[model samples]
Each structure stands twice: as C-alpha cells, then as structure tokens.
Target: MATPMLTSPLTPRLTRRQLMRSALAGSTAFAVMPRPGAQGLTGPAYEVSAWTGPVSGFALVDTTGKTWRPADLRGRAVLLNFWASWCEPCRAEMPTLQQVADLYGPDKLLVLAINFKEPAARAIQFAKTTGVTMPVLLDVDGRAARQWGVKVFPTTLTIDSRGRPRQRVQGEVDWTSSAADKLITGLIQA
Candidate 1:
C-alpha cells in the first residue's frame, strides 16, 4: 500500500482552487543554481544538485506492455518523470515535457511520464486530452513510486547515458525552456 507520487492515497480529491494555488506557489519556488565549476550552465526550474548516484534495479513498464530497463537505454539519456493527473503542477508541466521528448526523439533520449496509482484509462484519457505525447507508464499500485523514492507530484531525474542520475529536479519544470534544453544537451553529450 505504498502511496502514489504526490497525488497521495488516491482518494479525497482536491478542489480546483487548491490545485491552482499549489501550482502557482510551487512553480515559482525551488530550482538550485549551477555549482561552482559547472560553468555558464543554466536551469531555471531544475535544481543544480549533487548526483543521486546510479539508479539500478528499476524497470518502468510502458502502455504497450514493454518493460524499459536501464540496459535497454544504456546509450541514450533518460528523463524519468514521476507524476499524477490530480496534481496541477504535474499537469502544468506536461506540454514542456512533451516538447523535450519530441525534441530529442527516442534514439537520443527517453522521456518517460510515469503516472502513479491512477487508473490506466484515466491516465490515458488525461494524456489524450492534454496532448501529452510522451510515453505514459502506469504505476497502478504505487510500488514504482515508492521504489524510486519520489514523494513529489512531478519529480524528474536526468540520467546520463550510463544509467546514472545526474540531476534530480524535485518539482515541476518548464522542460521546454532554453536553459532546460542546454542542461539536457550537456547530459546527453557528457
């Protein structure tokens, strides 16, 4: 009975006003500046933090029933996002995440939008309605969320080509911004 990624226990719905407030407040907060030696890099929404180490023993299953493992993505960078439909910040970041996925394409990067504990139909419908073209993976029982230690509504991990996490952005982000683009480009090429 692990709880889903910040959408909570999957019950007790939040009102629209509450969602909006949460979105506005959080979207304006967080995001660390680059480190001392990182040079002219920029990340307006993603935190510039220490590496969280290699994320192994994790495999997220996609909508098509295909299991995506680290080995399968060894040569390409990965942006693993944990999100839920009920969370407004997560919803707000959808378009930018989609742009990142589409911009890099599968050969160079893998942007996974993992929905936590939400019904597959609801997740599918949300994506369809929201125009999020990223691959939607379901964490129906919340196990993946727990395993990943993702307690936030939309925490994104930028993993480099060797399956190591380079950055952990603990909130929603404008993944389409030029700063985000540069950060991701550096990860993929480094």
Candidate 2:
C-alpha cells in the first residue's frame, strides 16, 4: 500500500508577531525606494500621470468662512496642494510653495493649499506661522485628500487652464528651483 501523504493546512496563517514584522518590512521597503522625479529634492520620487477629466471636486472653507470650489479656479493654472500642520515635510515645503506663488502672481497662477483633516484654527495657525500668503483651504474631513489620492503630505498637483493635472510632485520639492520654475512656466504656456 502506498504511504498516505500528509497534507498541510489549506490556509496558511501568520502569527501576530510575524504579521507585524512583515508589515514593518514592507513599509521600510517602500520608504527606501528612490523618488525618481524629485529633480533636486531629497525624498521618494513618484511620477505624476496626466490628469484626464475633472477628477473629483471638493469644497473647503477658507479662513473667512467662505466655500471655495475647484470650478472657480478653471481657466487658470493652479497648484493644488494637500498639506497638514503636523507633517514636518509639509511645513518644510511651505516657504518654497509660497515662493512659487509669488513667482507666478495670483492672476496667472492660483496656489491653493488644502489643509488635510485639520481644523480651521490649526490650519490658520499653520499658515500664520509659516507666513504662507496663498489661499489656505480647510479640508476638515479630508474629503479632498482622499479624492486626490494624497497618501503623503506635501503633494502638489499642477492643473492647467482646462482643469487637468499637468504635473504632480510628491514629497518635498524645491519650488523655487529653476527646474521647478521652468516646469510651471511651461504649464502656463501650454
């Protein structure tokens, strides 16, 4: 008679410790991946695919308690940024974002910083502390962040006159760099 073959369990199970270790390993690996399109920045780089349609729209109240809509920004180049006060990288990138806003002027380019999942008071404080002069929209519920797929802070989406995302910058970016300026300028001309 042939020996009976011992079969393993149908489902493989992981111990709690093993699961934790695996999760940590996966996160570490993601963190170590090189940020390819960072240009001069020192962080993970991600390629921004061209935006196709209107994408998703979000409503955020400004400091003045007025609602701001994405449609209001049509027919103009816009920098749609998702940030938070607790994020160090977001804080670090604000000055450069401000510089970019200054470079383009409000008429030609609109820099809209949407504070993700933060209270209006906190967002206002952050803007005041950072000296960020651009319009800071409060996404109190993080609706816009989720819509924009913002998994990381300091994510910037550059929208053209037609409300399409032309470029996306993830992580921290030197917004005042010539490369950055050139990219924005090219978007404006497009």
Candidate 3:
C-alpha cells in the first residue's frame, strides 16, 4: 500500500495568467517592477509576483553534507531554486542555471538548488549525471519550500547582495538569456 499525498485546501490557486506563464518552457517570470536605472528595457520574459515574505533566515543541508543558512550567505546574491527530480522543466533549466552560477562565481552569487522532498541519493545522482556543480540543498520534508511560500515546482527566489528578497520567479527560466543576465547582473550590482 502507498501513502496518500495530501495538499492544503488553503494553497493559493494559480490564476489563468500564471498557468499561461508557466506553460512556456524556459520563460522568466517575476513581479513587473521597473528596475531602477533600467530605462527602455523590455518586459520580463514572463510574469509573476514579487517576493513579499520575511527574509530573515532558513536552514537546509547540501548534498555535500554541509548545512546552510542566510547568515552563511550574506554579502552575496543568492538564488534559491526550488525543484524536484521528477519535474521536467526543473531538470531542463538546470544547465543554464549552472552557466549563470559559473558566470558570476561563488563570491558574487550563490545558486542553491533546493530539491523538494526527495532523497539525497536522487539529488546527488541527478547532479552527478547533469554535472551541476552548484550547491544542491535538500528539502526532504518540504519545510523550506513551505517557508519560502513556494507553491509551484521550479520556483526561484532571488536574494540581493544585502540579503533582501528581490523577486519570486515561478517557472523555468533560461538563465543564459539576456533578460536573465540583466536581472542577475542587477542583483550582483545592487
């Protein structure tokens, strides 16, 4: 017998607009706030809301057995990517994410791949097969995801250098794209 997976009825329903946005593979989505000093820029590749939650702290362990928290990552822009091994879109955008991580380096930016409710072996194997060198954190109980208000797979939270939550992207994004580069560059420079 298998245990039944349950979901909260209070989980916020996704709007049709959101469904459309997430439908586009490798599309970037975030709040439509005008980036300061970014004049004549086009809209985001997709659309979603900004992060409006506490930026206080969180704790999760990486595949290498190291525990991490926000305090441990201050003075650097952090991209907390919530994903699961079975999610196709999540797997698809990973290489581009690695590219972004390598482009910025560990000092300027840290991209943590937070695997949702999966075993450590699974994430490790996926990282090994995919050659993702970034820190792959495990949310084995899904607590970190819930705390971060991630109701969707492949959601990414961007934290600026000052440890401020900047954007909440709720879908797959081609991190190598110009739009992604601009957003990440702004975070690094902020």
Candidate 4:
C-alpha cells in the first residue's frame, strides 16, 4: 500500500493576540521612513485585468519546508516579493520586509518572500543571518520569477485580497514607511 500525504490547509489560523503583535511590529517599522517608488524595479505595470494568467494561485515551499499558496492568501492583502540571496539590494531591504510582515499581521496581510533561483539552504542561511521572519518561498527554477515579470532583484508586487496586483514597486523600498502601511491597510479593508 502506498503511504498517504496529508495536505495542509491553504490559510493557517492565527489567534487575535498573534495578529495584534504582527500588526504592531509592522506599524513600528513603517514609522521609520517614507515609501519609495517602484521605478527601475520591474519592466512595466502589468494590466490589472491581465492578471488572469497561470500565475494565479501559485504555490512554493517556505524555508521550513512548508507550502505557501496564493489561494491561502485570499482574504488578506499580500506582498509577493521576488528576491535572491546573491542580490545586494535584496539583502539591504530585508529588515523593512520583516517590519512590514510584523505590522500587517499575518491574518490581514501576508508577505511572501519568493527566492529566485536560489538553493533552499542558501535561503535559510540568508534568513538566519538577516533575522528575517517573513515566510521565504523558494523558486528554484525561477519559473515564478519569470512568470511574475520580475526584471530586477527586490521587486515588490502588492496584491489585494482579490488577488489582483495593485502596485508594482521595482527596486529597493523602505517597507516600513507610513505610506506602505496606509496602502496595505487600505487594501486589507478594501
């Protein structure tokens, strides 16, 4: 007989206290600076309506070997960040991302750090070295990176609860800025 593999739920259930902590952390980080623009981060603004492609509901493995999917993020705002261990700018912006994840609360907003073409071991090492707490997903083949049109390192694509890409910030950004919190909070409410 073949062994069965139990599939995990799309969204993990988190307690109110945990949610509050994450939100507080994110807010405090955003208070430190202003939100930077997305110029030079990606190719172009992907048409909102054109988001009907295969990129929807994609899944990737996190640092802990758990699977993360877009479907799991349905009710929350999401920031899908494509990065790599070797990118200098990517390394520079990790703290802001950590703050953003803490501020938004996992229940209301999920930040998925998708590693482009990097080994899982390297990704894990990077996380430990940088103290990044956001879930880091591995894109070993760079398929997701190519699909999402990530032309540069540290491109951030903010997706609303409906899974539509709202803003594409290319290049490094101060993830903890008030503008970023306002935008994320607005999206969560929207």
Candidate 5:
C-alpha cells in the first residue's frame, strides 16, 4: 500500500513530503500554470522557461527620451517585458502591468517594457491610448532581446534584487491576478 503524505499549509495541494522532494529535485513551482489554448487566458498558455542566468547589462532610452541602464537597477526586483507594437496580446496586458507597477512601486519593483524594433512615436502613441504609464524602453535593433533569449513576443522576465534572472513567462499573463501578486511579492522580498 502507498503511504499517505502530509500536506503543507503554504499550498494545500502540495504535501510537505512533495515539497521536500521538489526542493531536493530542484523543481520549479508553477502556481496556476495554464495549458496551451487555455480559454480565458489573455493569450496562449505561458511557457514556463526558467532561466537562472544573469541578465546582460544594456542601455536603452524610454519613450520620454531618457536613457536608462540595466546596471543601475541592480538593487531592486525588475520585471522586464519584451513587447512589440503589432502584438495584440502585448497591448492587452499593458494595463495589467501598469496595475502591477502601481501596486509595487518603482522602489520595490521596476516594470520595464522593451519595445521590439518599433519606432518611439508608435510605441508612445499606443501607450498613451492604452493608459499604460510604465516606462517603455526602445529596443531599436533587438540586441537586448537576442542576448536575453527572447524568441517570443510578450515574454516577461523577472530579475531578483541581486540582478539575477529569476522567473520567465512566455506569453501574455494576467499580471494583476492575485496569484501573480503573491508571486511578485515573494520575488521582491526574496
């Protein structure tokens, strides 16, 4: 007969034994992972491609024509989103990201939207129409995207406080969801 396991209060579905097993096995926890073509999801099921490498440093200009460097944002958690103007899902998720930015201010978390090969005027117009106030960085030649292994549009990567790439979502996600809130909160605190 199989032995019963004790569940952990942190996640009722994950048992204490299972948690320990995952810890020992080096498992990436996905809290509410959606399958491909999952209805109600903003876009396709987000691919949980966990990249534990350090993000490359780069300099980019925001819509306001202010230059920013990745090296300057090392001490705080950063949510780097790769997006394009033509991507519908990317536009759809901007409001959610704005909400997240508002909730977790720049002090705790920095939400940066990197425009993929798009002109500053179009990106600025889109952001203005969509009511997304987060700073939008212009990736003129896809250099940063290539270095970050970003093959998909609307891909989101979070860098920890120490400037280490932590988690990644390969599609549009409901960033304002409570589950995401908890995840972001934990990442920031970590």
Candidate 6:
C-alpha cells in the first residue's frame, strides 16, 4: 500500500507589488530619528509614521473571553499594541502603556495589548506577573499582525475616534514621556 499525503488549505497568493511592499515595510520598520533638537522633540526613542495598508476591522478575544471589535470601540481612540511576552522591548514598554491606559480612561482612550501568536494562558500570566491591567487580546494564528502589516515586534497602531488609522509607531519608547503624551493627546482629541 502507498502512503497517503496530506494537503494544506489554499491561501491567496501575493502579487509582486505586495511582496515588495512587505519587504519595504519590514526593512524600514525601524526608522531612526535625528537627535532631539532637530525634530524639536526630546527623549522619544521611537519612530512615528503614517499608517499604511488596510485595517478595516478585527475581532479578537481577550484573556477574559470577551470578543473585542473595532465596531464596539467607536467614539473612542484606540491604541493597538502588537506584542509578545518574549520580546524584551515589548515587555519594557508595557508598564508605561498601562499607565497611559490608566491616565486616559476607557471612555477616551482604549489601550489594547494584542499578544502576537501567544496562548491565552501565557498572555494572562504575563499580564498578571507584570501588573499590566489593559485588555490583552490573543492573536494566536498571527493573522491579525499580518493583516495590520506589523512585521516588527512592539509596533503600535493609533486609531482616531472616527475609526481612521492615524499612525504606526515601531520600536519602544517611554509611553509616559512628554512626547508620548503629545501623541496620545492628539489621538484623544481627534
């Protein structure tokens, strides 16, 4: 008897332009900023760029088994932080994110820590251990990250109250800093 083979599910193929764009997005994920005075901002060790690609909507369940969707969060600015427990930068910046979440309150700003390809248990445990109180959504299959074009760890996408993507910040920065305040303030005021 011959051995049987298993086939995987069919998925859409990417075009040449899409491939190149993914390559470019990954390559330039980390944009270095010039020293303080040049940009007139000080001590923000991260890059901010306009959001690209389409992120019309997403539905992901959090550790508490609550399904969160963009539609449910209308009339509020959202900070979607793509992260994993293993990433050092992600871990380092989480506390500040928590503080920002606390300061802003859910009515105005909703900070969601979307755990990339991590189990719900791990995400919950990490949140408990780190004292991070924000909602931690699980992206177990990594489809959300790919959909959002987040090729880098610790990438943050800011969505305005009107549900438009405003900016994508790659890398870590002290979220409690003045620069971060300005950024978040703008989003809240939007």
Error of 3 at 100 (Å): 0.5
Cα RMSD of all models vs. native, in order, equals 10.5, 11.7, 9.9, 17.7, 10.1, 12.5
Model 3: per-residue lDDT, tens digit, 1-190? 5333222375333434444554543334434422223343223333455675576667889999999976877999988899998988689889999999999898999998999999999999999999999999999999888887787778898888888888887766789988788888878888
Best by TM-score: 6
**Candidate 5 lDDT over residue span 1-190, tens digit each:** 5446454455334334334433432334553333223332222235455677556567899999888886768788888999998987687788899999998889889999999998889999988988889899999999988888777778888887877778877666788877677668767887
Winner on TM-score between 3 and 4 is 3
Question: On a 0 to 100 scale, what is the lDDT of residue 151 in model 1?
Answer: 67
Q: What is the lDDT of residue 113 in candidate 2?
A: 90
The whole-model lDDT of each prediction reads: 0.72, 0.69, 0.78, 0.67, 0.75, 0.79
Model 5 C-alpha lDDT versus the unseen true structure? 0.75
lDDT of 2 by residue, 1-190 (tens): 5333322375223334333333432332122223223342233332344444345566778887778887678777888888888877678778988998887788788888988887788888888887888999888887777777666667777887666777656666677876677768877876
Residue pairs in candidate 3 whose N, alpha carbon or C atoms collide under 3 angstroms: none
- Model 6 alpha-carbon drift over 4 Å, by segment: 1-42
Among residues 3 or more apart in sequence or in different chains, the pairs in candidate 2 whose N, CA or C atoms overlap within 3 Å are 35-44, 35-45
User: Clashing residue pairs, candidate 5?
Assistant: none
Candidate 3 deviant stretches above 4 angstroms? 1-46
Query: Model 1 segments beyond 4 Å from truth?
Result: 1-30, 33-48
Query: Backbone collision count in every prediction?
Result: 0, 2, 0, 8, 0, 0
Task: Evaluate residue 173 in candidate 2 and report its C-alpha lDDT on the 0 to 100 scale.
Answer: 62
What does candidate 6's lDDT look like per residue over 77-177, in tens digits? 88999999998879989999999999989889999999999878899999999999999999999999999888877889998887778889877778898
